[model samples]
Target chain A: MNVLEIQGLTKKFGNFVAVDNMTLNVKEGEIFGFLGSNGAGKSTTINMISSLLQPSAGEIRILGKDSRKHSRHAKTNLGIVPQDLAIYDDMTAYENVAFFAGLYGLRGKLLKERTEEALEFVGLGDRAKSRPSTFSGGMKRRLNIACAIAHKPSLIIMDEPTVGIDPQSRNYILESVKKLNESGCTVIYTSHYMEEVEEICSRVAIVDHGKIIADGTKEQLKAIITDVKDLSIELKPGSAYSLQSIGKIPGVRAVNEKEGRLSIQSDAAVDNLNRILKSLMDGGAEVKALQEEEPNLETVFLTLTGRSLRDQ
Target chain B: MNVIQIAFKEMLLSFRNRRTLFFMLAFPLVLMLVLGTALANAFSTTAAMDTVRVLVQDQSSGAAQQGFAGFRAEMEKSGFAFTDFKPGMDGAAEVEKNNYDDYAVVTNSGIKLYGSDRNAVASNMTQGMLSAYADRYNAAAAIGAADPAKAATAFQPAPSGGYVKELSLDLDRMPGSMDYYAVALTVMIALWGAMSAANLVNSEIRQGTAARLVAAPVRKGEIFAGKVLGNLAVNMLCVLVVITFSKVVYHAYWGDNLPLVLLVLLSVVVLSTSLGLALSYLLKSSASGGLISLAVQLASFFGGAYFPLGVVEKNSLLGIAASLSPIRWANMALNNMIYLGDSTQVIQTIGLNAGLAALLLAASAYMMSKREGL
Candidate 1:
């Protein structure tokens, strides 16, 4: 069953639209990955879901209740870890957790036990008394996560939790997130890194221009460009070859060259490879190397959007 | 157990943070001590041998009229400005027209000086300078009548008449002492406490804890309430520190109304909390907001903070205008603490102070609640 659902969500700043007609759902206890480019409305949509921003025009239903009218109840079971580390610099990690616990109505022994559990989960029990500002970027990030989970929310939304941190912190965060998902807590994670999304997200949503362009399981999104695959060719230097003949080959679309590297596209990707390789050798094409890539999220991304997700 | 507990935590955070400590207690004390002491000394120093400005409309512009010339020179010698004007014009009118006081001279015989009775210091100084002039004139007449030659020497204008007022009071009661300044120092000290508390709210926004808090089931109002409690705790801590400091350092008499002073100080804390909360919201950068709020506090000093209103330029509008100052009221309440034997006066002062503090708190709260955390 869906624990959260958004319908026709829209947000705008002045005349510029930041999120438009965004809609998606999160299954109960599912690690939902929200994917988009830097300005693709992922955060904006998530903000609306987390009740941080009021949607310009849309409906957000959480636990089968209207979010705006029932925000008091909806927010009760929700916890958030923002992209920026928000721990108090003057407060010890334990104190930080303790403070947040107080807000969640946890007190006395209950608060202490929760704080300890969160600290242990984040692997910072020894350093719980240390100030977050004194900790390294990774340690601070971990503490940041610890504060959110200390509340023990049913729905935990993490927005770009691993930005600008050490690799170890990033790994720790990812592992912790997986652990969180394994429990009964519902997780909503947003990131632009395709590999990370492919690795952990049970479901993925690609959003752009304030709208969700596509959303499905990894296999479902990948199957869209199943017939199209990437082909790499490394030929001798200065060998510029225009294969009008290769373009006419069955199932072949076009051939392009870049720095003596040739990439070929075809509908019958696997079957057309043998015919293309044989023709290239027949034409005396000095092929130094040849490789084929099965269609993945990156190819599906290119096929769906007509632009690489990481375009500089 | 709820938001108030979080506020206590916030208050603790303020003390734990060194920057907040300086802003909460040390900052206001330093301001009151340095600025208060300097301004108070200025007042007492100026309050000493009164400076009076008298206008003289002398119709007889001849050597015979030169009789008043001795008076003018004597006035100048004694540190008064005895200004001369045309005979037809009124002396007091001329001074009043200049816009900071009242002055005039008498046209009648027997060398009478008609002084304008308007401001306190001016009124007191004018009467003294005129009497001295009259005495000298009488001596000159006596010498001129009996033995004109010797009388010239005897004509020392009545020795600057009656410079002292006839009053029965101890010398200790004069300028009200360091305790007078200390009461106000304590109340305003809460602003620093407020500043410390305000940072807790601001830190949440800065550290992203605010968003985390928002994501929880907690309402904004509860968060704000909790924050206020935190500041109040810090304020109380500083208040205790201040009371101890006063008792230990100055043996400061806050008044017989200890509870009243505390109540008024609480109101002051609330007001300052609202101000800091509002300020933290208006400015995206807490550092900048903190600075601007401190700058605005300069208004308190100008509003009769250092000493009594009469100490400044009693002749000027601003001097009299100081009577309406909130700091003046706060100080007056505490100053009146010295005379707590008179319950009526003490209650009145406390009531007025508490009322003003409430008004400030309301205004600050209304303004602060409008602030968006983002």
Candidate 2:
């Protein structure tokens, strides 16, 4: 059975919509990637699912329980690694883990053992007693994850958990998320890093303008951009400006000028490459750097949103 | 963790905070010492600049003049702090000598009340006091007397065997103005008031802790309760340490009853802490909390923590409200116990103070629970 279900979720602020008619579901043990650039309502959507904020208009079911009526019980089986470092700076890492463990109602020997297990999981068992101030930025980030997951909840939600950490800590966190999912815990992760999402997210959702424009397996989303992901051509200038003549090329889509270079978007980049090269040379357009670049998630994001993910 | 557990953790962190410790302990200590000593000195001053002293020049001749003795007793019994002077004494010279009395009470005809003409407030108090005493005494004299001559003469006129006043107080508790100054200064409500901005809500926001808590499983209500309860413990700790020190080391006569004084101080501390915490969550600036804490301290200052509010007109809101000052109640309870030279009179004082404290505390708790302006 699906462990989490959100239907027709809509969040409005004044007339501006933060999340609009969004819908999603996560099967048990699946690593779900909640992907979006900043302000794409990713956090807002997760906040609703996590029961931190009330939904303006939506229905959420957690473990078959109505989120509206049973938020506390819904929260019991879920672990959240918030976007910010939520661990208490004044407390020792172990104590921080213990405090959160107690929040899940974990007690006595179980609490202690779980704290130690979490610390060891994050590879910071030796530094359990050290305060966050004493840890490097990466260590603090790891400890944050440790604190959140100490209770071993069946479902874990991480909100941009690795935004500004060092590469090692980021990798460690990514690995931990993967391990937690492998251990039969459902995971929902949010991040601006496409590579991180591509690396660990089993199924990803590409959101834009508060709507899930694309949601599928990595291969499926990639297929959304089935047109030419790469192309190489040689021609003189003024070769492909007016596509009326060449618009009939079997799988060709649209074309744009990129930094004084003729770039083409088309299905079957190789087949379209032959058509573009043959037509462009016939029409006379210069193509100095003719390296075919394989389309990645960044290109996909730009195609869907008309802007880069990291743009301010 | 549970809310109480979270609160305890907050307390542990607060206890170790160097600035918090200083604000809670050191600042009050220095303030109490300076204020207690200064006030003690102010009360010890023998300046006649303005106190109603009734100097009796009893010239009734033989036993007829002895009437001054009984009259003096009656006036003193009616709460007139008096001084005796000889018939031909130089009152002004004696005042210049920085001796004799703060005011002069010389009885001739009906009565004569005098003070250095410059001090108007003292003159008014003196006149009021002497008038009341005369009313009470004249009525008593009219009631009956075995010897009308003795009552009229012997009782009204008496010799001045250099009748000087006696100091009735425990020498140990005689803290110089500096002593009470230290104690009073410790009663600083700045920390308590600033609690809103500095210790409770503002600081948490400043550090991004509040957002962190919100994202966690903790509810907003739990966070609110935890912060208020945690900070209150720290405030009470400061009050307890200072009060305990004052009693053990200086014997400043804190009602000679630990539980009563403790209850009063605890009430004030909780009241101040809650007011501060509620305001902290209400205001925007961290500095606003600090500013409000200073307001709390200043309110106590106005509450007569440094001096008797009774000497102040009980008409102004602050003055009248000062009757409700936790400091005043604490002082009054202690004074009644000390001046009455017994604990029997303290029951009413303690009861009154305790009741006021309860009311303030309940108001604070309700305000804290309902306040969500921010």
lDDT of 2 by residue, A65-167 (tens): 8877876777777888877777667888898889878877789999999999999999999998888989988898898788778888777888888978889
Off-target runs (Cα >4 Å) in candidate 1 are A12-16, A232-289, B27-177, B192-201, B279-291, B294-297, B304-309, B312-317, B320-325, B339-374
Q: What is the lDDT of residue A44 in candidate 1?
A: 78
Docking class of 1: acceptable
Per-residue lDDT of model 1, residues A1-312, tens digit only: 888988888888889899988778898988888877778787777778777787889899888899999987788777788898877888899998888777777888999999999999988999988887788888988998898898788888888888788888888989999998888889998765677777888987777677778899888888777668778889987554557878888877546676888877677544878787778777777889988867667667666665666561
Candidate 2 has a DockQ of 0.21
DockQ-derived CAPRI band for the predicted complex in model 2:
incorrect
Question: What is the lDDT for B2 in model 2?
Answer: 67
The digit string of per-residue lDDT tens for model 1 on B135-207 reads: 6666666677898677656654344455577575544344444565567667666544445545656667777
Please list the C-alpha lDDT of all candidates, in the order they appear: 0.71, 0.67
Residue-by-residue lDDT tens digits, candidate 2, B235-342:
677667776776676555443456654555555565566555545445545665557756665666676665655566678777677765555655555555544445
True contacts kept of 1: 0.78
Interface RMSD, per-candidate values to 1 decimal: 1.8, 3.5
**Each predicted complex: what DockQ?**
0.47, 0.21
- When candidate 1 is compared with the true two-chain complex, its DockQ is 0.47
